[model samples]
Target: MANPPAVTVCLAGNVGRYKSSLPVGQLLLRGIMAGAYIAVGAALCTVAGTGVAPLLGAGFAKFIGGAVFPVGLIAIVLTGMELFTGDAMLGPLSVLQGKIGWGKVLNNWLWVYIGNLIGSLAYAYIMVWGPFTQGALGAAEPNAFGLNAVAIAVGKTLAYKSVGSIGLWSCFLAAIGCNFLVNVAIMLGITAKEFIGKFFGIWFPIMAFVATGFEHCVANMYFLPTGLWITQLFPSLVDKSTKAADGTVTYWSPLLHKFGGLTWGDVWLWNIIPATLGNIVGGMIFVGFVYYFAFRNEFPEDLMK
Candidate 1:
């Protein structure tokens, strides 16, 4: 058996209340765990999707990445860790339900977001020195996975940088689409009564967002830095040139040539900041507000009490 719509909404708001009431230490700790868990999924997607595009085609590669990408979210949901994107919806919903104030919601978001960033950066550092590189940290060459990380980073940031404001708008739109699906998955997770049901409930929408090429801020926190670290460590890899028999340059990585390399500015300016703002709107307004209004009248009086 599953929760009815009204019951699920009430439960979600209650969960939000509980989350917002957590101590700062607990919030940060859980946030870190959630961030690492998400990074684990992102890493798996990267490794799993490697070399798949050319053989199975881009669509299949996307499907494969999407299919594996939900593992982190599943872990977070089941274990009760804090994720900023989910909190973006949950905290606001709690506020709407009068279970918490905006201040509490903001506090939760701030600490959780910081924790998520710290965890992501930590995991990215681990990945850079571990699987992504084959040798000692300082002298290592980026393995195939590392190269792919660089490419992924470049695509996420520089691709947007190339086009300026329109690119930022595009990223913002993609982020809204991302967190919208993410919170939909969160709602399904709450609605399901059984583990298997919850698993599939969360899986599909998360998969859809990733497969559809939407921008997710938390996921990008891991993706961008992993790529940036690789490129920064191996500066020569930033731009590769293919020379003809006559020693004339025939090919260069278009992104590397155009933008040079991923920078902190590019990562924040082009992707993360816009993506974060868009995620807030997507989750807080699209899912949180919409669902609360839809179900507010029907919530059991006992739930409110």
Candidate 2:
């Protein structure tokens, strides 16, 4: 994060002997910040799914959830923020090239992970408030992006593990492919520094992931919990003959009636945690660190020393 202690300078004793460190806490903080950025992007996409998306009706609504994840990730990369999944690649690279010790990668992973959860929760709060209070996006009488959005997310999430359990590595493979594009998206957005260049950079991966049905870790952060929140907050989003202090609270029961006994736990247990883990593994070990091994030649000579 702080330029990897400048391998050349440290190795040369330019500033006296120094050791490379991951400083677990710092990596965690970066992860948290990255997560918050991602959560915001998730909320934006949710709003788009409910109302007028930034890209307009051009993108598919369901894929809109997935699309927003990378869009948010690319922005974080462009902004030079850290993310766990992307870190997975970088962390390993650092270790393999001797830029940082193995201890650092583990520390970095722990921090980013905790931070990612905090960011995800923050996004959920904004999403519930957006449609509930302002009706900002011109949602339907029963907004799918509202209560229905969660339900659909729950269904989509389970499909992955259920398929995975049947020995379908499609989801696992998809996760890897998503990383290649995801990293590329970050590369373009972060380094390209042009709107269309960055946008087009993201466009190809975003489209490819959608077209090929790749698994994304961050989108699930918003989608799965948001679904549970929808189930939890369903009571809050109802229309009232008389508006009270608790319109959303009132809506939950009746929506359950309409949907036939939906439970919030189902979203959490069957969908959220598994999908979240899949996403984490996909981002960290699968995608992130793998690249580290592949690109050891790019490192500064100090690291080699």
Candidate 3:
């Protein structure tokens, strides 16, 4: 059976408070695992979504990709790992409940965010040198999966930059939608009394967000780096001149060439930076504060202390 919303809110607050109290080392360790888990899902989504749009239909391919993307979060929740996005909500909520202070909340977020970045970079390297490659350090051409990685990175970064300020707003908005749904999934999981219930509860909202093409900061931690690694190893993929119908070779993705190729700068300015801001707003205000007030009157008296 499902848990009541009030019960779920209290449970979430307690969980957040307990997490805040954990040792920094423990938080970092768990955060690393959570980042890797989220990367696993991101990789799976990339592979599953590859060529799917062409073979099937755009909508169906999105469904397939989104369907597989929740495995990481499921593992994180069930196995007890610290993900930055979920904690973005949980930490502040604990602060508001008077169970933890602002310092603890910020401390937890800082360490976990660092750990997550390290883990994600590690996984991104593993992917670029292994599965995404053609069994060599450098290739004249990247394989389909590698190409897809590059494409994904480009779409997230350069594509947005091409449109200027409006594009930044678009990515920011997408990030907000993403974490809002992600926290909903987390809340639903908290509401479930059984594992299966939690599994399905978390699955649906996650799938919805990914299928809708929302930006997620943790997942991008993997996606962007992996793609950057791939392009570096195979620089040809970035600005290869291709034969045109008019018999002159021109660069692929005009804007990509115009931006002087994708850089770490573009990755942050175009996508991750704004996405991170949106994630905070989405999780902290949209989910964390909203739920706190929604069930404010119903919190356990002991918890109010």
RMSD of each: 1.4, 8.4, 1.5
**In candidate 2, what are the lDDT values of residues 80-135, reduced to their tens digit?**
56676666555554455545666666666677777777777677667766653344
TM-score of 1: 0.97
* Winner of 1 and 3 under TM-score: 1
Worst 10 residues of 1 by lDDT: 250-259
Candidate 2 lDDT at 292 equals: 47
Query: What stretches of model 3 exceed 4 Å from their correct place?
Result: 248-250, 302-305
How many pairs collide in each candidate, listed in order? 0, 15, 0
Which is the leading candidate under lDDT?
1
lDDT tens readout by residue for model 1, 164-193:
899999999999999999999999999999
Off by over 4 Å in 1: 136-140, 245-252
List of clashing residue pairs for candidate 3 = none
Using TM-score as the measure, which candidate wins?
1
Instruction: Score each candidate by Cα lDDT.
Output: 0.91, 0.54, 0.88
Ordered list by lDDT, greatest first: 1, 3, 2
lDDT of 1 at 255: 81
lDDT of 3 by residue, 125-219 (tens): 88888888858765586778888888889889888998999999999999999999999999999999899999999999999999999999989
